[model samples]
Target: MIRAFRNEDSEAVVALWLEASLQAHAFVGKGYWESKVEDMRTLYLPLSEIVVDADEATGEITGFAALVEDFLAALFVAPRHQGKGTGTRLLKLAQKMRGTLELSVYAENERAVEFYRKHGFKVVGQGVEEATGHLELTMRFGG
Candidate 1:
């Protein structure tokens, strides 16, 4: 089931973000993701429009997407629940909410880059992320 993110979902959401980040962004140091946990919990998540995918039977949050206007700030699924269409479902919901969407993904995270591309997002620009000195690709969908 897809639903709005409640305050109580903070812990689970951040945990999933951390785990997924660690797995998908292996090139980045683990400490970097760990250091951002508090910011994700208190700053980023709070400031974005977030939606969660919950288990229909247990109501456990399995995945989530966060948006700041037309920009997809974050999308993550629990490591255990990935590759099961949850990410696609969340992305479709985001598309329905905003006809145009933009986002940046680490260039080294080929799985993510391919996933976004398969979903109709095209790489429009590229740059080095100052914080991590990693190549980042800017992708756009719709207009």
Candidate 2:
């Protein structure tokens, strides 16, 4: 089930992060997972418009998605739970409320780039994020 993130779910959310981050960055160099975890925690913690997906049976956090105004900030699903429509559901939820949606995705993350494109976002700008040296692709949803 999808719901708001609660304090009780912090550790599970972290676990979801570690699991999904490892899978997503497996081809990257070593220590990438740790650095990403730290970066993500700091980036999303203070955001008020965040939603977490929980596995109804286990009550474990299976994924998470967040919206910062018109920007869809972060959407992640655990490796095991991916390809099961969770990400799409979250994306649709974000679209229902935001007219001019936007997001910054890592240039190297082709999976996410394709996903966003399939959902109608187009690359409108690009730059390197100084803090992480990650190439960022800025995408927009509105015409």
Candidate 3:
């Protein structure tokens, strides 16, 4: 089941974000993702709109998606939940909340790029993420 993120979920959400980020952006050193833990917890999550997909029985958070207005800031699914449709469900929930959305994905992360494409987002531009110097594509959803 999907629902708003609760304060008690802080650790799980950050852990999921770190794990997924490291897995999906393996081109970058693991330390790169680890370094963001503090900011992810103190800065990002508190400032964004986040939703989580939880196991109704165990109440374990399996996936989560976040947005800052129309910008898709973050979306991550625990490794165990990958390929389980949890990611797609979270993305669709975000779409329902924001009719049009924009997001950036690492150009080297093909899986994520394709996932966004399959969901009606098209690459509108490309640039480097200053923090990591990784090439990224900016995509936006139409209708």
Candidate 4:
């Protein structure tokens, strides 16, 4: 079940983000992701339009996608729930909500970059992310 994010879901969503980030972004130090938890909870999540995927039977959040304007600020799935189409479902919802979407992904995260490419997103630009000095690719879809 896909639905809008609620304030009460913050903890679960943040945890999911951390877990997914650690798994997908192994190049980034763990401390960096940990340090951003508060910001994700209070700043980024609040500033974006977020949608979560809840288990139909258990109602536990399995994945989520956050969009700020046309940019996909975040998309994460619980590790245990990944490879089960949860991420794809969340992305489809984001696309339906915003016809044209843009997102920045770390160039080193090949799995994620390929996922976006498989979903019809194209790398429109690339640059270094000043915060981490990591090469980041800007991808776009339907635009």
RMSD of 4: 0.7
- lDDT over C-alpha atoms for residue 115 of model 2: 97
For residues 1-143, write the lDDT of model 2, one tens digit per residue.
88888877766776787787677655555486676666566666566477888879988787887788888877789898899999888787777768789999888889999999999999999998786688889999984
Candidate 4: Cα lDDT at 129:
96
Q: Which stretches of candidate 1 lie over 4 Å from their true place?
A: none
The lDDT of each candidate is 0.96, 0.80, 0.94, 0.95
lDDT, candidate 3, equals 0.94
Q: Residues 71-135, candidate 1: write the lDDT tens digits.
A: 99999999899999999999999999999999999999999999999999999999999999999
Best by lDDT: 1
Q: All predictions: root-mean-square deviation over Cα?
A: 0.6, 2.1, 0.8, 0.7
For model 2, the local distance difference test gives 0.80
Candidate 3 C-alpha lDDT tens digits along 1-143: 99999999999999999988889999999998899999999999999999999999999999999999999999999988999999999999999899999999999999999999999999999999999999999999965
Residue-by-residue lDDT tens digits, candidate 4, 46-142? 9999999999899899999999999999999999998999999999989989999999999999989999999999999999999888999999999
lDDT order of candidates, top first: 1, 4, 3, 2
Residue 25, candidate 3: Cα error in Å is 0.7
What lDDT is reached at residue 74 by model 4? 97
- Let me know the TM-score candidate 4 reaches against the reference structure: 0.98
Highest TM-score, which number?
1
Per-residue error (Å), model 3, residue 70: 0.3
CA lDDT, candidate 1, residue 87: 98
RMSD of 1: 0.6
Pairs of residues at least 3 apart in sequence or in different chains that clash in candidate 3: none
Measured against the true structure, the TM-scores of the candidates, in listed sequence, are 0.98, 0.85, 0.98, 0.98
